[model samples]
Target: MSKTIQMPALSPTMEEGTLAKWLVKEGDTVSSGDLLAEIETDKATMEFEAVDEGVVAKILVAEGSEGVKVGTVIAIIAEEGEDVAAAAAGGGAPAPKADPIPAKSEAEAPAAKADVIPAKAPPAAADNRVKASPLARRLAEAKGVDLSAVAGSGPNGRVVKADLEGAAPAAKPATPATAAPAPAASASTPAPVAAAAQDFGIPHEVIKLSGMRKTIARRLTESKQQVPHIYLTVDVQLDKLLKLRSELNAGLASRNVKLSVNDLLIKALGVALIQVPECNVQFAGDQMLAFKRADISVAVSIPGGLITPIVTGADSMGVAAISTAMKDLAARAKDGKLAPQEYQGGTASLSNMGMFGIKQFEAVINPPQGMIMAIGAGDRRPYVVDDSLQIATVMSATGSFDHRAIDGADGARLMKAFKELIENPIGMLA
Candidate 1:
């Protein structure tokens, strides 16, 4: 029986994928769980595996093919020894393509050869001391330098411009002077000619935009141009929160775990979201849909793209659980091996550039999610606390809300609750 191998959805946001590489050629043997090809999604390059055993009959999608929608037939598998191409053309069953098999040892591949030069050439004396044109020989004789001593600086190592100039002066070698260094040669020579001023100019390379870059550009452009965004700013004192994180980390470190201030903030946000469920609402067309679970998405940067992997049921997880889950997700994200369930179903997002020293920034809301938080670096600043001027560690968190789901007041109220939670982090443990 012939079977079609359609493109699979590698990620929740992937409507289509690019066939980056095909591991199997036509007529190869395939088995269930064998890797068939590599597909580049919006976030990463994922491996496509064969689910059944068969011979490769035909390849509908070639390597480097793009814009293929999910579930679109890309290849066909045919019966053993069957001609897949002829079968497919005749509207008959196609043959299966072989999946890539991994090599078990380095000996299976040929070793690279080493480059070496043989040393059996004639010695300098017998090799005819020097080869030079008659005119050049005359010039060297006139300059009183041995031709053998001057390496040819011209084409094919032939002596040319300043072979004579580079030769030492004919005077006998002088004795070294033993004295204090005289005023370092007062005359400064012009900086060695500025690398000849690169007439052709420095070369540059042109790279085509990847799928993720394209999506980011399009969405951000639409967001800035169409979405009416309003800004709200509030500073929360973070001295106590910092102390709490340090103490908890000191104790946590004994258990082979470490936590960052961002982790604590994520936990705080999760707690606040439960109390203010309005912030957990999503804009579904004309309706506002609220979610019961607080799935918090944390933005992680992979080599070629950015991905937001979620912490499911974050509202119910403790600070340590949230921290551990986030670390696991981040590690897998960097490795490009995260399953679809790891990245999908986030009700809200948190983007912290504080570790990178960004003071503050406004972020675009991820679609369907009513809000996204942008966090900045915490620094010491002066503020009035009960009519007394004091220095305190403060940080700012800004939320971008979807007006269709959350009103201005609703977003503000959620942010206000978050500010209080982070400011009084001890209350978050409750």
Candidate 2:
């Protein structure tokens, strides 16, 4: 008998993953708790451990294979006294087919093992007729650049976008607003381009999307198209919170705990959610799911896309604790070493682009989560206080809520509660 190893759902939301590497080859024996492979999940790279000890009879999925679906048989292990070759042949099922790319004329180009790696440039053109990609040919024609003059930079003397870097882009001819629309060249639809024509004459490179980027695109597109989002913006005074952070940092300096603005904001949002439970809910097709605990998903931008690492029971964790936890999670996230449990299943999210100096912006909701708070940079601004105008440090925050689950009034109240907590500073702690 053989034991089948299926591609794992590393995160709760993970439907597929990139089989980044195989730590063990065919015929290698692995014990329980041993690291078997590195699986690149939707958010991070996680170590896949062997749960049952056995001899690796076969690997159905190749290393570096992207978009491996969960529950698909990826390998087979021979049980004790079992024939390795027979077990390998008896592997559960064939690898699943990858989801077909959306029918927007597929990019006509040779895809590398991973991202499109630009081939190193050759010393000179190999042939009289310059070998170039369809996109390169179109671009060179449009720009009137001599293809022979550009050196080959892609595999096998092929001229790719990278070779055009020094060349100028073709400018689009102007069209007056009053001009009539041009008709299609043919009555039928155009065939898919092996390489989409690039109107630009300038040399550029097309980097293929990685697994993470693909998932982000699909999820965000679905979020915008399906979710009924209503945004509510509020201006919050941050002077109190700033002071509290400074004082807290000084007191905790000996203990080596430092708090960031985002950490404090995470606490405030968590408390606010608890105060206004009506707003802390998810739309479950038929009804709203009101969560009891406030688990905050703090957005962390990684190499290819953004991920939200959760702080479970954020309402119960102190500001200092949140800071420590967030720092650990963020560092691991960047290194692609986070566990599935560390980054999944949060009630709400908080995205702070303050460090990037963004004034304010709205964030898309992660599916199954009701809301996301977008935080902007805090700076000195004129405000009315005590019947007098004064300069105070203030920031604009926007909340994007799922209208299906949370009403307009509840959304507004959640924003008010968040603002009050930041303004008072002490309310979060209490």
Of the candidates shown, which would achieve the greatest lDDT relative to the real structure? 2
Q: Report per-prediction Cα RMSD to one decimal.
A: 17.3, 8.9
Q: Report, for every candidate in turn, its global Cα lDDT versus the true structure.
A: 0.70, 0.79
Candidate 1 segments whose C-alpha is farther than 4 A from its true place: 11-13, 81-204
The digit string of per-residue lDDT tens for model 2 on 7-48 reads 888776777777889999999999999999999876788889
lDDT at position 179, candidate 1: 50
Best candidate (score: TM-score): 2
Q: For candidate 1, which ten residues in a row score worst on lDDT?
A: 104-113
The pairs that clash in candidate 2 are: 108-194, 108-195, 164-203, 165-203
Error of 1 at 247 (Å): 1.5
Q: Give the CA lDDT, 0 to 100, for residue 7 in model 2.
A: 85
For the record, the alpha-carbon RMSD of candidate 1 to the native fold, in angstroms, is 17.3
